[model samples]
Target: MILYIKYMVSLRCKMMVEQELKNIGLHYVVVELGSVEILEDITLEQREALKRNLLKSGLELLDDKRSILIEKIKNVIVEMIHYQDELPKTNYSDYIAEKLGYDYTYISNIFSEVKGINIQQFIIHHKIEKVKELLLYGDLNLTEISYKLHYSSVAHLSNQFKKVTGLTPTFYKKLRRKRDDNLENI
Candidate 1:
């Protein structure tokens, strides 16, 4: 059986869910962001206990269809922007609509209604975050970062980065370098 989880977005959350399953004496084949696959069927007692345990960690076991769909949307964006090595070449709306098998308009409306921000804005937020991470790592230049994230150009990436963070990517890199150097001196 496959179970959906709410607020299980990060690697740490996946670990926590795995531990909870072990504690509950349930064996899961896989634990991933927003969902888990169990090898054996679960009992009501196990499900209730797992729900309560997950709640203690600020996570939730989802039950409703709308909630499940919302989590799926978030998971897709998170996986695409953060985990994938390269952003998809296709437009995000097309990618998302294809992935979820729902009309773009339908899910976009639901996501905006529940998340209070449109999905495109959410994608931009995550892409900017990825750019920051790459800048700090010192592995990719602005142009390369922009290409990896599928921005039109380095200038476009810098503009969006500045608008979201109030700091140019160059400035952000400098600040991180200074901070790291200061830590090393102490």
Candidate 2:
């Protein structure tokens, strides 16, 4: 059985999910960002138990199909922007459509309807959040940060950063304070 989870974003989340499965004597074949596959079918009682346990730990077992699909979209974007070292050369819309096995129009429409924001805005929000993270790490220069985030140039990155943050990247970095939207909220 494949179970879609909410807020399974980090490595720690993966570990917690694995532990929960083990504690409940469920054998999982795989656990990857927002979803898991188990070796055996789960009973309703077991499913409820899992859901309750997850909720207690600030996680959720997604039941609604639309919510599941939305999480899948979020997972794909999160992996691309925050985890992956490189993005595809093709446009993000094409890449996302291909990766999700859905038409770009459908995905975009559904995402917008459910999230109350367009896909492009969501991507920009994530990209800016990533820039904040990279800046906080204090390892990459602005030029390198722009390249890593697939921005056209440092000027473009700075402009977007300022637009979203109301401060230049340099000033934001210098302040060493966090100012960005939460991933789950976005």
Candidate 3:
């Protein structure tokens, strides 16, 4: 049986889901970001127990088609931005549509209706968040970060960063370092 889960965003959420499945003695074949497949079909009691357990940790099993589709879209973007080292050479809309096996226009319309924002907006948001994380790590300079994140140039990255964060990446990095220094002193 395949079960779709909502709000399974991070590694911690995946771990919690895995632990819950183990606790219930289910032999899961796979547990990816937003879905799981088990070797055995689950009983209603097992399903309810799993749902209840997951709810306690701010996750829910998605049964509705629309919700499941939405989660799949999110999972694809999340996997691309957070997990993959390099983005696709093609346009994101084309990549996403091809990957999901759906028409881009239909996907965009449904996503906008469900999410109250366009898919591009979601991608930009995730990209910005990833940029923030990379900046915090301080392993790469601005130009490298821009290239890694698929930004056209350092200036474009800086403009988007400033537009979203109200501060440049350099300032944001310095602010984080100062805050960490203060915490260490405390």
Best by lDDT: 1
* Candidate 2 least-lDDT 10 residues: 176-185
Q: Please state the error at residue 94 of candidate 3 in Å.
A: 1.5
lDDT of 3 by residue, 49-91 (tens): 9999999999999889989989989999999999898888889
Each model's lDDT = 0.93, 0.91, 0.93
Candidate 2 backbone collisions, by pair: none
**TM-scores, each model vs. reference:** 0.94, 0.92, 0.96
Which of the numbered candidates is closest to the native, going by highest TM-score? Answer: 3
By TM-score, rank the candidates, best first: 3, 1, 2
Which stretches of candidate 3 lie above 4 Å from their native place?
Answer: none
Candidate 2 RMSD to the correct structure = 5.5
Write one digit per residue (lDDT tens) for candidate 1, span 99-140.
999999999999999989999899899889999989988588
Q: How does residue 72 of candidate 2 score in lDDT?
A: 93
Candidate 1, residue 143: Cα displacement in angstroms equals: 0.8
List where candidate 2 sits over 4 angstroms from the true fold. 177-186
